[model samples]
Target chain A: MNLLTDLIFDYTLRNIALGAAVLGIVSGMLGSFAVLRRQGLLGDTLAHAALPGICIAYLLTGSKSPLVLFLGAAISGWVATLVLLRIVRETRIKEDSALGVVLSVFFGVGIMLLTFILKHNDANQAGLDKFLFGQAATVTAEDVNTMTILGVFALLVVAVLYKEFKIMTFDPNFAASLGFNDRWLGVILTSLIVVAVVIGLRTVGVVLMSAMLVGPAVAARQWTNRLEAMVLLAGFFGALSGVAGALISVSEANLPTGPMVILSLTVIVIISLLFAPQRGILWDIKRFSKA
Target chain B: MEIVITGILISVACALLGTFLILRKMAMMSDAISHAILPGLVAGYFFAKGPDLFAGFLGALVAALVTVTLVEALKNTQRVGGESAIGIVFPAMFALGTFLVARFFENVHLDTDAVLFGNIEFVAFDRLFIGDVDFGPQSYYVAGALCLINLLFITVFYKELKLATFDAGLAATLGFSPFFIHYALMALVSVTSVGAFTSVGAVLVVALMIVPAAAAYLLTDKLPMMIGLAAGIGALSAVLGYGLALAIDSSVAGAIVSVAGAFFFAAMLFSPSHGLIAKARRIERQRVQIGLEALLVHLLNHEGEEGEAHESEMLHLSSELRWLPQFAQQIVGVAANRGLVMQLHGHLILTDNGRRQGQQLMVH
Candidate 1:
């Protein structure tokens, strides 16, 4: 009861919880498409690739605002995607190898730039490093507003283009034959994913942001065969973990919210994989024994 | 100087293993193992009551194997995709490590920044000693031994590794367990990553491994050549990256990886056999050659026909053969350059050589 009242009354707690839920809902929705297209690791690469953009944003603007950082992250992540595609198309390097290259090399550049900023700049650069392993406790109401606006915008775009995205995800050639301009659709989908990744960076950081994108979607997959259901369930799972992680971290003295959220999502995945009907491993074993 | 040598040795070790890794399409596995080993290092430190190296290696090895096993198990369940399993497991393990680091080791020597992107700047001061006898920088010895071990491993299992990598079914039929080779290679990768962890950090370890190996892959087809070239590229990148870091006053490991990336993009654009520029040039030359042949064949067919006048007109090349005006003009210029065609009053006339070449092309 006290915790419930605290959740309602506490200013910092309310902002953290609201911010986390928005992150969860948005990432979960975009992650469904990523997982279905077998690009689960794409989120990981994009998150790592966003580091340099964040640093550059700070360097160029001298602002730590979420909106500026998100724009910077989105632009660089989009560039990385284009480079990734060009490598795969023009060279003999495979997609997996290209992904690794972009992820690591871009991150290295980001770190180098970060160190350079630290050496040349003043103490104002202190908060910039927080993106490495984010400080969820530091997310203010203004940050929450930025996250909400971005999340809502991404969700709206996905909703408006749901049909095109569906066809493109399942049978891209068929979508092309249907005169859907599937290439542009793919670009838009990835763009939406980049937005989701940028918004989550403040809460989860780069190292663990991939989990927020991947975990709920994978868990949602075990429960349903329909894409619509999977997406909704993923959002539910994401929000559940987010709120749970926020509450638990608040209760604990030293626990960080990001890892706790990831840990919560991990438990959800374990449960879904073992117990969901029709696709569950436990169900499979039981059916085999009966047979 | 010692830092450069340490960087070279470590990069070489990573690149040597990385050649096989890229070939096996397990490049990202190196990334996963690098991050997953953090919790193990934290545990190792906790258990040993200090920063003991052997305990850390053992714990990290166990952690790496566990990660591999979990990924495999998830994949075996037939639910999670292989890359998805990797994407899921590593971050969970990394997050757990971060959680542990934040909770327990906040004031300890195991700082998160040092663990993620190593402080190679201060590595010259951390010397290795044995019974009051100074050996030198500890990372140098670690990197040197790792390079030797990886070299020996590759040498001893060269045949087995090759067969398993290219054709697993044949390797199994020939009595080599592809599974054993896979695990053995992974074990070695884990050990090498732990060795490189203190020097280059976790993320740059992936850069050193994948970038140089991938660049070498683009430049060659032969396996032995690829391995040698990967090592060479890694060493060169280390030297250049160190020089860059010195100039910029930035992270040494980051500079090294960035240099490695520059080498990769260079090779991608310029390698003779497989480079984009070379390939594009080849395609362009082929297009012109095809245009030349088509022009020859078109002119030869109408050599003595009643409609030869209209068909052999220079303007008719585009109208009849569907070639663009510029392309048709370019083809005519090339044919005239080779003395195969002549422009007589704006009409394209096939010379005797052109007729002969057309006859030859017809035979083929």
Candidate 2:
């Protein structure tokens, strides 16, 4: 009862909870496309690649405002995607190797820049490290609003291009043959995912942010074969974990919210993997035993 | 100097194993193991009541093995795709590690940021003393031992590793257990990760293991050459990275990885066998050759026809073959320069050589 009242009445708690929920919903919704397209690790790479952008944004604008940092993260992440695509297309390096290269190299540059900024300029660089592991407690009402706006914009695009995205996700060649500009559609989809990574950066940080993208979507997959249900269910699962993680982390001192949220998502994944009616492993075992 | 040596040693160890990992297409698995070992290191610390090295190493190795096993299990279930399985497991393990650190060791040296990028700057100060005798930095010995182990492992298992990597079915049929080779290689990767954990941190460990090997891969095809080149590249990155970090006053591991990335970029663009520039040139040459051949075939077919004069006129060439005006002009210029066709009075007349070449092309 006290916790519920605190969540409702407490300003910081309310902001953190709202911000986390928004991140969860956005990543969950877009991550479904990433997973279905088998680009599940792209989110991880994007999140890592966003660190350099955040540092550069600070260096360029000298502002800690979420909007500026979000823009910086989105732009750099988009560039990383372009680099990743070029490597795969132009070189013998496979997609997996390219992903590793981009993820690590971009992150290395980000770290180099971050350390340089720390050594040269001490002022206003305090909260910059928060993006590495994410501190939900620092989330403010304004940050929440920014996340909400971006999340909605991304989701709205997804909603508007729902059928096109579905076709592109499953059969991109077919989508292209149908004159859907599948390449552009793919770029749009990756851009939306970059948005999700940017929004989630403040709440889940970069390291564990991919889980927010992969877990809920994977969980949602076990329950349904349809894209629509999987996306909706993923959003719901993501929101639940986000709020739950926020509450649990806030209840205790020294508990990091990002990991807590990931832990919650992991639980959801295990449950979905074990108990979903048609696809559950237990059901398979039971059927096998009966036979 | 100690830090540079430590960096080179660790980079070599990782690159040696990384060559195989990249060949196996398990590059991201190294990334996974690197992150997943965090919880194990923390758990080892928790049980040991301090940051004991052996405890952490054991804990991390166990954690890495568990991560590999779990990913394989998940993949085997057919419920999750391999990439998705990897993407799911590592974060969960890392999150648990972060939770442990936040909960119990918040005030200790087990910082989250340090785990990501590492604190290699202080590695020089963290000397190994044996009975009052100073033995330089501890990381040097750790890295050196890992290098020796990886070198020996690769040497002993070269044939089996090669067969298993290139053709697992063949290895299996030959009574060699692919599963054993896979797990053994994974275990060494885990050990190397633990060894490099403190000096380069987790992600850079991946950067070291993958980036150098990937660059080497672009530059070579022979497995032995690839491994040597990977080690050489790894060492070069370490030296360059050390210099870069000293100049910029930043993270050494980050500098090293950035340097490694530069090397990969260079190999991608300039490698003679498989580089982008070389490939582009080859493709351009092929395109021009095809265009010239098509022009020959087109002209030969129109030769002696009722509309030969009209069809063979340079003015009508673009409309006749649907070629763009610029392309038609360039082809005509090349053909004229090569003495295959003559442009007299705006008419394209085939030369004796052109007739012979067109006849030859027609046969093919």
Candidate 3:
């Protein structure tokens, strides 16, 4: 009981909890677009792609300003998206193939760059390597502040573009006929997705970021048909997983926060996918049996 | 020249397997199979010690078969869609594989990175010798043999494969076993994927399998033409992507995939029958036709109601329709030329013959 009180009172633990809460809210709101677009993989790809950008930013600037690294990450992420789009548009390749291709290639390049950077750079580069797997314990007050500002910005953008985003997603052709500038809408939505991914990458790492985007939204989708309700539910689920993961990781010394968060989200998704009332697998089976 | 020859051979193999993958709509299964085979690869690494390509290939093959069989069983028993089964099985299996790698083989050289993105640079290091002369690269032979085997198997059972793919029910009625064909196709996919694992890795192999076939699909509907086109596209992409990668100092697989995407985009926009551009043009033409028809109907309706032709109503009708003034004018001109309307003192009146023609047009 004494150990539990001491652990909870620790500043580091409190900071991690706060950071996870902000990340949870942001990912939950943005993941809806990702799930709707069937871009559950984009989060993973963009997160991995951020490695080189962060490394390059460090190399060029010689300072680890979260703002500069984030800018670099956004640029690389957008480039990856462009490459993915170009591949799907130009080739006879399927969307998933293009996604896999872009993801692996960009990630491979990022890994190579990271390896090179680590070998050449000083020991200060140690923490940077942790970004690949994530070390939520290392998150600072500065990170929390940055996350809060970005989260608010992302939520505001989503709020402003909610109607247009919803219409374009459900029926793009109809949206286009209404002169809704679908291209701009796509760009805005993608930018928001990229930002959400980059922010989550700091907490969850590249490998698990995609799961964060997919898991909560997928689970939330089973519970609601209305877009607003789905987004809210997804955010709530994301927060729950984030808090639970943080608590578990903090309690256990060797357990990694990112994987724990991912596992929690995965459990939520599996439950929703299998057991939720309306669109769950169990529901489908029940209906089918009756027929 | 040697590289181009090797690329062409690989492309041909990819094309053959790609067509069946696309036709079966199991294109994304290649991606799932690649990831799910990690445990097999780790196990292979443990036994083989070094980078035993064949061991990895066999392991991956076994994993692929397991994935396919399980997915098929789930689909049959649970009455689930292919995508749902794939979604559930692959991720769970992949997570399991990841757990194994992380827990037991953390320090081992075998990692997800190595399996997912293959080292093409190292592929040339292994050369299979035919007596004294080196037979190009080892992967070429391995992938080539699998491709040939796949092609032969597909060709021998072409009729059955086609029947199963197009209409499994019809094949069943005609005394053909779709189950056998399905298994054979999955086996071929497994072999091709495992064999290509060394050169392109798991992800790029999927790109090779799906992209070329998808591009070919956009260009043609006939199975034979699609197969041929897909092979050509795959070969072209492999060679071109290699050259482009060399030129840019980038990853070869990435370059190839980007190039394939470019091809697909071109087909989507410009293909004569099914391209988005063509579809858009068709929509535009239909809209024009509808507008003209609506204007003609309005004029005919007015003419039927009036004993005398009225110029005021004709002018008023043009303004009321609002959107397509030019199309409306064209309709009026066409009607007038056909002697459907007579012009008197700026008032247009429909003749008895014109009224009869209009009524006939409405009926049919």
Candidate 4:
């Protein structure tokens, strides 16, 4: 009864829960594509890449507007993808090598830039490090609104392009023989990823954003084979973990949202991996005994 | 001095194991293992009551083993690719570790930043005292011991490692257990990574374990040479990166990675035999040689045609045969130099040797 009252009456709890739910849905939707395409670590790269963009945006605009900073982050995330692709295509370097290079180099630049800003005593830099680990209680209603609009837009694009995405992922040659333009499809897909990553970066921080992207999708994979089922299940799992994490963190003064959220996601994965009927560890054990 | 020594020790230890990791195409697993060890660190701290090296090693070793096993188990299920399995494992462990830190070890020096971007400069402060004698930074001794152990292990198991690395089936057939070697290698990698993390951080350890070996790979074909060159490259990157960080006033680990990246790109571009430039130059030379051979075959075919076709003039060759004038000139120049063809009133004529060589080329 008290929980129900807080859900409706406590503005801070309501805002945090709603915003986290939105972030979870967006990340889960896009994460399906990322994991299926075997670019699972791309989320990690983009999240880290967003830091310098946030810093540069803060320096240029002197505003803490989430919209402006997210734009900067999205742009840099796109640039990081471009560099990763170029390194793979033009050089003999492998995709993994390119990932490491971009992850470390861009993150180093961000660290250097952030340290520079702090040393200069910029008053605007107050609480900037919160982006490192994220504080859910601080999320405003305005941020929740922004998250809802962007999440819906990302989901709409995914729905509209579902056929193209399926064809492109399962068989690019067929898509290309149909003249569907693979590179353009890739750009669109990556942009969706960047949007998902940028917004979730606020709630999960740079380090844990990849978990948000990968964790739920992995859990969902144990339960289904169809893309539609996977996407829906992943979204459900993501929201469940997100809300659970928020509620858990709120129960304790010292607990943090990002880690708690991640822990919640991890629990779902373990449960799914261990007992999800056909694909579960318990199923394997049972089959082995019968055989 | 302690910092530099520690850097060198970490660099060499990582580079040694790195050679095998890169060769196995499991370089990124180092990244995975590095992040995944945090839970073990936290567990070790809580259970062992401090940052005990033995306890930390055991905790991290269990975590490392679990990480590899889970990744392989996921791969065996055929549901997730190797990369996806790796992507799913480390973050979970790292997040768990972070949560543990926030909940219990907040006031302690079990810092995530220190784990990620460890400071070599501060190693001097963590001295090992032996009966009132300062034995220098604790990390130096730990890292040096690890390097020695790595060297000795590789030396003792050199033949087995070589066979297993090059051909697992052959090694297994010959009574060397490839699975044993594989686990042994992972154990060394995990231990080395932890030792190195006190000075260079786990992320930079990945840089040391990969970039140096990859750079050396661009410069050598033999494993022995690759190992030697990789160690040298690792040491050089550490020293050079330290100087750079001092100059720039930034994180030394980051600087080390950048320097190692610099070495990788340099080797990629300019290695004498395996480099991109050398490959491009060889291809260019091959193209010209093929073009010259084609010109010879053409001249041989049109040996005596003085008809309206204007068979062998430079302009005729450029227009009729689609050869550029400069290319025709180059072919002609080569033919003339070899006494294979002669120019007669701007028309081409082949000598006996040229006709003989062309007919021999035709037969082949």
Assess chain B of each prediction and give its TM-score.
0.98, 0.94, 0.83, 0.93
Q: How does model 1 score by TM-score?
A: 0.98
Taking all chains together, the TM-score of candidate 2 against the true structure is: 0.97
- Docking class for model 1 is high
Rank order (by lDDT, best first):
2, 1, 4, 3
What TM-score does chain B of candidate 2 reach?
A: 0.94
lDDT of 2: 0.92
What CA RMSD would candidate 3 show? 7.3
* TM-scores of all predicted structures: 0.98, 0.97, 0.69, 0.89
Q: Give the winner by TM-score: 2 or 3.
A: 2
Once superposed on the true structure, which residue ranges of model 2 sit more than 4 Å away at CA? Answer: B301-309
> What is the CAPRI rating of model 4's predicted complex?
acceptable
Tens-place lDDT per residue, model 1, B1-364, is 9889999999889998999999998888998999889889888877997888989888888888889889889999999988889988998998788788778877777866777898777778889989999889988888999999999999999999999999999999999999999999999889998889888899888998999999999999999999999999999999999999989999898899889999999999999999999999999999999999999998888889999889988788898889899999999999999999999888999889998999999889
Candidate 4, residues B1-364, lDDT tens digits: the string is: 6777788888898889888887777777887888888898889888998878778878887888888888888888876777778877887888888888888887888777788777776888989999999877899788888889999988999999999999999999999998899889888888887777867777788778888888887789899899999999989988987787777676677777778878877887898877778878998878777766776788888766666237777898878668888877887897799898888888777789988888888899
lDDT: worst 10-residue window of model 2 chain B? B285-294
Q: Give the CA lDDT, 0 to 100, for residue A229 in model 1.
A: 93
lDDT of each: 0.89, 0.92, 0.71, 0.81
Clashes of 1: 0
Distance from true location, Cα of A266 in model 2, Å: 1.0
> Which parts of model 1 are misplaced by more than 4 Å?
none
The per-residue C-alpha lDDT of model 4 at residue A243 equals 90
lDDT of 2 at A230: 98
Task: For model 3, report DockQ.
Answer: 0.15
